[model samples]
Target: MRILQKYLKGGISSHRYKQYIICSLLALFMVGGVCGEYFTNCSSLQPGQYLCTEVNIDPRTQQPRGCTKEGWAKVLCTSAPGIICTETNNGTFEREIPCKYTNGYSYETALLLSVFLGMFGVDRIYLGYYAVGLAKFCTLGFLFLGQLIDIILIATQTVGPADGSHYVISYYGAGIEVIRMDNMTYRMPQEDWGVVGRGIKEL
Candidate 1:
């Protein structure tokens, strides 16, 4: 308010006043962009979708302490007791049974980078492949052939982060569905041991 009053009172030059307005507008735009991205990426999780809120090591026991939407929950689909808890690259436990995890890597960002700056290997570098990124940069994406291949791979999600982490994508976006295996889903052979042995001998 004081700065604006000073500018209005002719204490500041008109040119400098215009510069201040432009800078303030630019700052506001940048802040808005950041907030929009945060809402879209971090806070848009759907109901029943688990997000790993935090993970840490217990000082006394040295055991991994993982907290998800369920609060200190380590396993998903506990009634089925199928998928066990697994640690992700981002120091969080994999909260979903199908192994959906986000290591701060965005599928859209990767695809866009591959489509636009792939020749410069920006996508590869962003995916954590420094060596391959350097090679692609030096060879100009292998004369653009590698770039094409990478674009397709990233589009289909065949290639992901170099640390073996999955990309963060929209909930309804393209993804691989893995069926969970549990006691009900799997059973031991019902055949008698003697009969199986006889059959094996005949074979």
Candidate 2:
């Protein structure tokens, strides 16, 4: 009887700890996920925040060598030909925005994903949107009126349906894949959908 009681008590303790284990896991995920989003959101050093906006600072003066004040502006970005704006405030540091320029995927793939896998909301998930994925799944697409917004969003990088920071769809996924806008090929990876080595031109 004593031995059986000891085993029973240990099992009970384990069961009690199981709930704590689950709760700890949930807490860790919440903290890690929140920290990830907060740091990444404010990390953007881009100026003007729009493709049409002019550089917030004068490039020559933007650096400490010349003028651009710390609170004033950090970097000069002209949605001009290149993707340059980087650095927060008037600091001398900057990092180029990835996927800001064309990277790779394809209009056709996004169209196909929307047309075929849309009902599953896999299309939105593939676009790096989890909440949208849940929402579309919930309405059974009775909310497809949202499709109009989606279409325009897939049409151009500039057309942000939701907060761009929320949807970091990898270049290898949906969105524009090597778009040949205005005779000039975009600066995106020249590969087919998710294919490995073959370049679009060679293939």
Q: So what's the TM-score on candidate 2? A: 0.28
lDDT of 2: 0.47
Weakest 10 consecutive residues of candidate 2 by summed lDDT: 60-69
* Candidate 1: residue 97 Cα off by (Å): 4.2
RMSD per candidate (Å) reads 27.7, 24.6
**Tens digit per residue, CA lDDT, model 1, 1-203:** 87799998989998998899999987897666632222122123344444444434333222233323232324322111122233332212334322344566888899999999999999999999989889999999999999999999998888899987667665455766545698779866597989889999999
TM-scores, each model vs. reference: 0.43, 0.28
Q: Where in model 1 is the C-alpha error above 4 Å?
A: 1-98, 178-203
User: In angstroms, how far off is 158's CA in candidate 2?
Assistant: 4.3
Error of 1 at 63 (Å): 22
lDDT of 2 by residue, 1-203 (tens): 55346556785476656676688777897666642222222245355533422233322222122222222233333332222234332222332333231223334565567666665566677666778877877875546766655665665654332323222344335544344467555567575664554465477
